[model samples]
Target: MRELRILRPIAKLEDAAVLDPVVREVHRVVDAVLKPRALEDLLHGVPAGHPMHPALVLVPAGSWIGAAVLDVVPGASRASRTLIGVGVLAAAPAIAAGWADWARSRRQQQRVGVVHAAANESAWVLYTASWLARRAGHDGFGKVLALAGFGLVGFGGYLGGHLGYRQAVGANHADAVVQRFPTGWHELGVLDDLPEEAPVRIEVAGEPLFVLRRGSRVDVLADVSTHLGEPLSDGRIDDPGHRGATITSSLGSVFEVATGEVVHGPATAPAVRFETRINGELIEVRLPRS
Candidate 1:
């Protein structure tokens, strides 16, 4: 466990070494080239509960595979090569959308994502070369390029698996509840003891909870930031309204805490709720639970 914990940071560094520069350049180009409308359209399916990348994988893979088949066959038509080229071109936008969504993630996730992007980009380059070789009537060179492109795709796919499964890039890191407290209302202390509009760090059954007192009503939330598991008590609270409040992380990811509504991505689910006893009454409030 100790070694594994240490390895996590090292792994992050390893990923960052390769992904950081690559992603920064990619993001710059993408931000400049893609219009707001097109970018919105690209990200629409992602927040709507569907992964855009998998939908994208189909086009390039299908085209490349088809091209490979045609390359081996005797007298494959010019129309078939053109169709494959078109498929490869169409796949670029889907790839861009997937990368854009991935770029906004935590540093560790971004690291793994960078390698994934590198792999895919290499595949794209190879395929583009293959298309060009075919166009120039260098069938032998084109076949070799197509095969290399396929190899790149396979390598990139492995990296994508690492990013998704090992790094948990697109996965919900917030869903894993590590702190399970006992059921029923727990005593958090006297109501007047808590300072107004200030985050009071309190431990409940060994789990940390950030309690915010607003007059007689106490608003409690998990002291941990769901994004990187940073202490939420360490975060800054801004614009505390009757309806909602925003907890801005040290890294600037804003978690909107309404009375009962959760609005944000990365931390898709609501922070856990804990019932606390204050002033001889059981008050219900939301707090992060393990």
Candidate 2:
């Protein structure tokens, strides 16, 4: 069964070093074309706090599946053709969102995504031809094309699932790790450990956090960037904003360490803020939810 799985090539393709530049150039084009933050977010699913491609894909997948059902019915040929046309239309937006996300994913993920997209696009072309053939009264040829297209789409979907679930392209990176911090305050050793206006990574109850101290006032936020779960402590602290000094994540999302509000961000979610109180010699912290 392992040998029979055609979709296994997607995993193998991740190790194909030859295609790296092709993938990089494609991502560069996507980033260059989708320059506006809002436009990029719309395709990336930032508003939904998850990747948007999966949601958009449902339209094409659904329309095709519905058309397949109609294809076998005696009086449903016209309806099937119509549904196929709808699927073709839906594929446009789905592919757009997918390309947008592919730009933001890790290199390895983008490698696998390239083949996955090719397979889907091949299926889309086949399906489009099949629809046109059916409309032109080439019923026998249309059936064969439909079957081929369906097989391609199914294999492509299997690869897409691998990309999403196995490679972890769009997973929420911070939620589980940051939620483990204990309620109420505990000592973080000496207050001197935190440097002024620098984001320092500290482990609190096994949960990683960023500590930024400005004079006597100390601020802490979850160390993970809400955008891609990159380490926020590895980011830089900029000049003061209205709420507090701004910390820029590795992905260029900006957050205020004091209040955890987004000053300018690729992430819609605010950095999780921790309330800090200096108790004499020890620095104490507590989860805001607690």
- True-vs-predicted CA distance for residue 11, candidate 2, Å: 2.5
Give lDDT per model, in order.
Answer: 0.63, 0.79
- Candidate 1 residue 33 Cα shift, in angstroms, is 7.7
State TM-scores per candidate: 0.69, 0.86
Clashing pairs in 1: 177-290, 178-290, 179-290, 222-288, 223-232
Clashes of 2: 0
For residues 141-257, could you state the per-residue lDDT of candidate 2 as single tens digits?
876887788888998998898887888666666666555667777776578866766657888788888887777777888888776788987887777422457888777677777
In the range 1-290, model 1's lDDT, one tens digit per residue, is: 35456435535544456666766786677556544643543452424544466666778777777777776778884754775687679778767766655655666666666666777888788778877887888867877877887887877776677666766654534444443655555677777677877777888666787777777767776666554556667777887645477776663335665432234433333454454445464444333341
RMSD of 2: 2.8
User: Every model's Cα RMSD, please?
Assistant: 5.5, 2.8
For candidate 2, give the lDDT.
0.79
- Where model 2 places Cα greater than 4 Å from the true spot, the runs are 1-9, 189-193, 240-245, 252-270
